[model samples]
Target chain A: MVAINKEIVTLDPHLIGVDWGSTCLRVFLIGSYGEVLATRTSAQGSSSMNGSAWAYEQSLEQLAGDWLQEYPDIKVLACGMVGSKHGWLEVPYVACPSDVNAIAARVMSVKGVDQRRFDIVPGMAYRPANGVPDVMRGEETQIAGVLSLRPEASQRSCIILPGTHSKWVQIEQGKVTAFATHMTGELFAILRQHSVLGRLMPSQQNELDPIAFLRGVEDARQGMYLGFAHQLFAVRTLGLMEMMPPSSLADYLSGLLIGHEIQAGLGWRLAAGLEQAPLILVGDPSLCAHYAQALSHCGVLNASILSNTAPVGLWAIERATAGVHATKLAHKVNV
Target chain B: MVAINKEIVTLDPHLIGVDWGSTCLRVFLIGSYGEVLATRTSAQGSSSMNGSAWAYEQSLEQLAGDWLQEYPDIKVLACGMVGSKHGWLEVPYVACPSDVNAIAARVMSVKGVDQRRFDIVPGMAYRPANGVPDVMRGEETQIAGVLSLRPEASQRSCIILPGTHSKWVQIEQGKVTAFATHMTGELFAILRQHSVLGRLMPSQQNELDPIAFLRGVEDARQGMYLGFAHQLFAVRTLGLMEMMPPSSLADYLSGLLIGHEIQAGLGWRLAAGLEQAPLILVGDPSLCAHYAQALSHCGVLNASILSNTAPVGLWAIERATAGVHATKLAHKVNV
Candidate 1:
């Protein structure tokens, strides 16, 4: 489905960057001037495609149908769980110390509907000193975006992507040196939604109480007397003792999980002689704010949040591969 | 119901011990000599009684139908979740530094279906140095049984009751001075049954592989580089890496949870200057063995398992109150 007049389409949009994650698909339309022209998002994630490669293609085509009709030759750059084993096409992980260029170089291309090209970015694998291998999918792109936006971050920084599987990544010279994954978010969700602790949580939705959340962080920080397993029970005990309200239970749990994560992640960094390193928090604003607050509680004064870096990261990776693909298209048009 | 001839029941059986828990009800028929004449068990626990006091009484009557007929005047001793807030009757917890006598003195009696005496033992509560209030119900009775069986356990012993919410109690001079609860077993079950980690486990039931369990225990023991939240992901990673089979995931998870529990429990005990104290493990045999294995892995050589101490503890509590109750009953008979 290559257009006869490739020159005409080349004058349209430069790149269409997509972050196809496990549960959500986010797309960014980048103009020739490297600016975000338009953006779109859908609930059709890798998981919802139901393991069918064809279903993923159909969903992608449907999602990008209107844009493709206007700019038929726009190249698509994708990242995250869309490249996982359970995703449409499995992409191999680039072992750390990997940079944006290294990740961009290993991008796997799959034939999209009507001859459109889809470039899927590879994730990063980290084997820490503990010998257990840790991996991250979508966060690598965010990290790439962070490095792209702030080149100063490349010198030495800890970028934390807080979410379901919160990641603590160490970057040096724009390369991810090492990283660890904490199941804090997932654990908090499950405990609050499915465990006995759920019974004590308020039925109605309540805005996160910062006071309660900080108290939880304090509980975890000062809870050297007991491990997390034991400290977790305090959530219920405190509720039973009327020390905290039912509505605050969620925030408290969130604080406990996030606090414990920071303690472990930062503690490791401190032990490894990176005590003075700058920290960058990345994710949704609310989540990032929580992390920043937790960091402050731990006396980490230099932490800052990088707001909405996934699109920037996707655009950066797309830019790396744009020249090569552009040359190929130019040659085809001349022929 | 009380028999018309009180002498017959007094001759028949002196005590009927019941461990009415959240999900199961266990009853022990004790002769005047304190030997278990017969036993009965059912799934009609406090939870199954569905917040109805009448349902609990009816369920109790049905469970002890034959025993009640034989010895209508038999004094009943009950413990466990039966006295919880949502149980048949909410019995107040006896604050710690509580022994068999203290617990027996606070035994709550409920009006039975007819004239039978239903005596429920009070649970124990401990506010540790960390100032978190911890409570245990049936396990305290088991601890009482441990103390009854081995009086030496009364002097600076750590009694570990391994189950859904495992309790580690510090007993000094036959008194439960303090205790802590670990959501290890509950956490393991939820992680395997509800979390994403369950996806890597086998669907079919497989026997607990000791080797795999020990590996998990070793992983937790040596996982100082990360917290349990981070190390838990190793279960999924190891499965994905093919380092461990899907079938062995259950056993491995068991090891990790139990290992973490022991580490936290024993670590606290050790910190409290009980490093040389003997550990008395009281629980079901299978669960006890796993804890024992983990304890052994942790280099604790003085650990012993106390199998099925509920009956002994129940009998002991019963004996404590038998004289006073009998004297009251004789007074009634004379009147």
Candidate 2:
């Protein structure tokens, strides 16, 4: 293995990357080149595991212990929903672009807290143009870790992170200046499950026709004259089906919402010949792929799909405080 | 009662009434000397009860079942939501200024429906200036009923019927020349129930503050450039609680949406003092109170709030039909 960078104390390769969440805790034992070596997993979801320190802690300890049995002395990296209030050690929210070290500052050494010492990561916060305050617990780390990997994306880029809550974050040189979170996910859920529109759509989410999806993008770009619900009903009442296929409705809903988020985030004249601003998307491969396709319709062709930084964040945390002191030793020599 | 000329049926005294669907559907049971008579009642509602007959049919059945028990031979009429797909038998919609008899003729008789020999009134429909087709179902009958009660309202008047689906109807002379239904109710439901805004609001619908409600109006008036959802999240995110109590979020939501509707419906020109057109409101006293309050914000003072007209519609239908019968008889004589 290549010599370990003294500036960052990490094994030539690391032990495991831990992501403890409300539902599931995933562990990725990765190598130096970010290749996942062996995966040892355990079932210890936060929400399900009542705030008991013993059983839940033991579940994680067993996971790491099993990994150590294989390598005997590999380092571990962890981040994600595992650092929240209900997470393993209750790591707090960190301000954005503060670097991997500041995030690790919140990472406390829990003696007997677990089988070994592990650091927890913090999230990020944003204030939007409308002056509305918003925060993301795990996604911030991913964005930062992603930024850390590719410095080029740090300039004049908007990150469309789609999830249950789609967040459009404005980043300028490694700093998350502002962001807006659109309730696209919840809207989809309610529309598909609760609202009358649900009747017209499939019982399950599936492929949306491109034509219908584009119509939704046009509506979002138009920006005025209809409420989300009003616009939603119009799709049914105005006989959008007369022009477009019925199955396209779901795709249209997803496109309409995400396009609106993009439109709002990229606050310029949305009408007329479109602007060619590049969009950096951080989401599931399938969704971001669709979103990138949708963006291309509006002349946003240079859209880059960024890999998820959850594992990168876990790696960053592990490298910050890994076996045999990387950063500390590097700093001593530099001084 | 004095035996008046059959031609004088148009000048008959009528009842003041209310319908179930949060809007109008009223009739007046008045004596020959304009004295109040027995007022018949029925539950006013508009949800599409698919397994059952049209909503209005059920409404008519309920009223007829109750009233026939008392005045078996008394003439009855009604209007508003009951005139919709959910209302009394499906009345084929007529284009507006499109009057009383046309509505009656279009009314479908529900087979083995509500045990009554009454005609349910239909509203008006029209093609908009934008070339998109639009229509109203139940409110037009009441507007006609209102004009029948106070013919003076017919002289270039604007009737504001506020509810879930608020309609601002224009009456030139005795005709409802045009009208548009704002999906205010649908917007309200989505805003209050499904949006990110729901979190900012209190679980109890009643706990609203008025000052914030007024700001909701101003926000709409000044053009906060907000998509209706922002008005909600603003309350919690901006700490609008500092400026106005959170209770007003409901009213603000109501006024902001309605005001936005007015902004859009009145065709961008509504802001340059919409008071140039006199507004006559036809709705329940409670909702009318809100309409009056909102209209004052738009600076249209002393707007008239007429009594709901489902009952008057019931009576007006009888009067109009009676006149038609008289005309048939007189034409027969003339021929």
Top candidate on DockQ is 1
What are the root-mean-square deviations of the candidates from the true structure over C-alphas? 6.8, 8.3
Instruction: Please report, as a residue range, the 10-residue window in candidate 1 chain B with the lowest summed lDDT.
Output: B326-335
Taking the candidates in order, what DockQ does each have?
0.56, 0.19
In lDDT terms, how accurate is model 1? 0.79
Residue-wise C-alpha lDDT for candidate 1, range A1-335, written one tens digit per residue: 12222233334567787889888987777655344556677999888887787888888777877776777777788899889888877889899999877888899998865666788999888866657788889888988777766777788888888888988888877789988889998899789877778888987868879998998888888884477788898888878767789899888888888888888898878765667777888888888999999889989988888776777678677766553321111221100
Error of 1 at B114 (Å): 2.8
Specify the poorest-scoring 10-residue window by lDDT in model 1 chain A: A326-335
Error of 1 at A111 (Å): 1.5
